[model samples]
Target: MKDGWSVFYITKNAWEEMLRDINNAQSSIYFEQYLFNDLEKGEIGKIFLEALINKAKEGVKVKLLIDSVGSTDFFFSSETVNLEEHGIDLRFHALSRKNILSNIFPNLYRDHRKVLVIDEKIGYIGGVVIGQKMEHWRDTQVRIENDFVPLLKNSFDAIWNSLEKTSARPHQYMNRHLNENAEGFLGNCPREKDKALRKEILSKISRSRKRVWITTPYFVPSRKMVRVIKKAARRNVDVR
Candidate 1:
């Protein structure tokens, strides 16, 4: 594992760690998510929102990209205005009622990634979202550090540049020092065919010495993969 590399088992703990990182951010914070908003008045949601606002007030470049469908209500609500007022660069993805047909098809192709890249040296990737319900879900996340930060930073830049914005600020965090040697390729669904993470897991299973334990909330394995597991079990390999 890299210097900043860590795993969070549950969503609530993940969010707490995320907020701590956000509070400590010195230069910039870039976030992309599937959903975000306040469900109750002056709730934890508001606290996190205000934290971003305060960071922006302190000259930390705060930019956010949210999926339109997942955050549809928030995108059109008054809350968005407040976020914008605090100098938060907020952009909604592919949302347009004028192009209803195109929007309908792309609804399935969401920005499912939950990413928080702070100071361009620390990056967080996970299944957690900015919502109360997500706290109850069993999710996993990774904190990364190293050369991969620049690649992640470049990806963020590409997405930011592709969006239409009135103003764009430089991410000073990109100049921050980093520890740990990290290198990995970006993986996106629909756009990319091979799921690198999936392949990695399968490879680990194939190389297992003793019992192979597997756990997933959703277990929709392919027929071919099922056959492999059955063959492994028949060969006196203990698999659970």
Candidate 2:
């Protein structure tokens, strides 16, 4: 809803936009997703996978991070070998026994965000994942081409380095570079303890001047979110 930016509601154009960005990546491509499998989905799922491998083979630095539970089969499949052979730095989130034990009491908190950043120039964030089933589902994705790309890149680097057990310092986020074209700040929830993202959502709802619309495959919300919604409704704001 901001000027100087074009947002694509990519239910119909999801694969096209994703493949385009991956194919055009010059220096680097980073992807993080909850689902990265194509088992039952088949051929369509292989499209992006092949594209990533191709780019990596061409010397584009490519890193992919997938949630272990969501893409377990694909992560263990023979195709993963092709990724390694092609120089793709593929990794899984929460895939190790050490991580499980470190959680104390294991929970299902997942890296559910689907993000793809290409060469620090273009980025995509959305609900769409790499799978055939998603091809027919209604979903939205945004391709950002602005100063926000660095912010997205920093986030991907942080998560990627953490999964790889590297000692990379998280880049401090700076908003001074934001201009009129910049939409707004991006809120990240890299861990369950990170509540900034949830607070941002609740704050937006609380400040809604008109209606509030939400669409999620799952409706699980925190108690604070519930209270904010109720309060918004009490003020006669349309809550849907």
Candidate 3:
């Protein structure tokens, strides 16, 4: 399944590619990441804030959603001021202390997705987070152009809609036309014991004919999944 996809290995100079894409975005840019950095202060963050601000100035609709806990400093400090000054709608996900009860119960459910959707057509998703640390950290990202963009957009809209009433937008693009043939949503929630997507991933790996190359910063797997991988390895399958 991954064969036809063009994989680009970005070691240190991958920022240029991301910047180039952001620079060329025409209509809108929707970014969601675990962290964001202000480039002016040399935080080793994804130094594309300037370009994002420039794009907004050029009449491009820009919306950035960053995790409040993961990007605590950038969210609370003045680092995000420039982005707001240029008409970019910036939001922090689930960083409020007022909701003490909810925070205590589901504090681990942070927005771990690193997604960038341009013009509601091209989508980027992967393990890459935006920051100076990302420059040195090994990571992987995929550029997708299939019918899955609407699903991604809907996921973002769900989060945006659940914000405080004052923080909610007018749902301008939420109901806009989407390309046909898009697949169903691939949702993930750690609290859910079923974990359908995770099961599907393990099932695919067990059925693969070629070598299995897993690359992830976090490697916490369930006991059933570990058994499946062990079984595959014992079957003389190439597992890595």
Candidate 4:
């Protein structure tokens, strides 16, 4: 572990590690994933669902958030009803009538973050989802054991609390811990049109001296971002 963080390169391995952590959680488990699939087909999803149910039975606070569009299948499945029956505080982000309109023109307004915080002590952040299809993808996950876990938990809480209350804002709830981490800060695509994550990524790429290597499934970046990347490449920054 590097300064209270352990990075896992394989997607399957990350799932296994998270499963272990979920089993060992004492107080709470907060999970937010973009794509959460059905348990029947996805072994990883089944394992995690079982673990969460068991923990909730033991009186642990289990909260889960899934993107409405990405996890549409799972959200409508019996497994989600089972989670609610087991007293799991499961919620879907933006699973609404407006979502039907969004299908025509998807934008950055969706919640696509993958994060998990257990007992407000251990946290996981990565690209892999709870599905069998993700097993073949080359993804990376970081398990963090530090005060930073609370920051992640707070972010999850902010989103959860904002689902019903219209006056409260997630950005204001998360602002205190946004830039507090000494090593690296937890970021999000703010609901109120704040492109904090995008700006940070662009700033890092613009300042890269030797190389900037990135691997992502989505490459539909903004035109300004495309220009910044081209400028970086012109400056002999090995961009890939």
> Tens digits of per-residue lDDT for model 3 on 81-191?
877888999887764466767677566667776778888876777776767655765667666666666567777766666454664342222222234544445556565
lDDT of each: 0.73, 0.74, 0.70, 0.80
Best by lDDT: 4
My TM-score estimates for the predictions, one after another, are: 0.75, 0.82, 0.79, 0.85
lDDT of candidate 1 over 1-240, digit per residue (tens): 556578988888888888998999999999888777664566556667888999999999999888777877677778689989989988876555567776665456666657789999888876777777677688888877766766676666655564554435321112222335434545444433465556766776666667777766678998766876777787777898
Off-target runs (Cα >4 Å) in candidate 1 are: 96-103, 161-182, 191-215, 228-240
Each model's total of backbone clashes: 0, 0, 5, 0
Model 2, position 214: C-alpha lDDT score: 95
Put down candidate 4 lDDT per residue, 1-240, tens digits, no spaces. 988889988888898899999999999999999988857844777878899999999999999988877887787788878999999988887644566666544434577789999988999987878878878668889999987777777777776776654645433434334533453464665554665668778898888889989888789989988998999999999989
Taking all chains together, the TM-score of candidate 2 against the true structure is 0.82
TM-score of 1: 0.75
Order of all candidates by lDDT, from best down to worst? 4, 2, 1, 3
* Pairs with backbone N, CA or C atoms under 3 Å apart (clashes), candidate 2: none
Please estimate how well model 3 matches the true structure, expressed as its whole-model Cα lDDT.
Answer: 0.70
Pairwise TM-score winner, candidates 1 and 2: 2
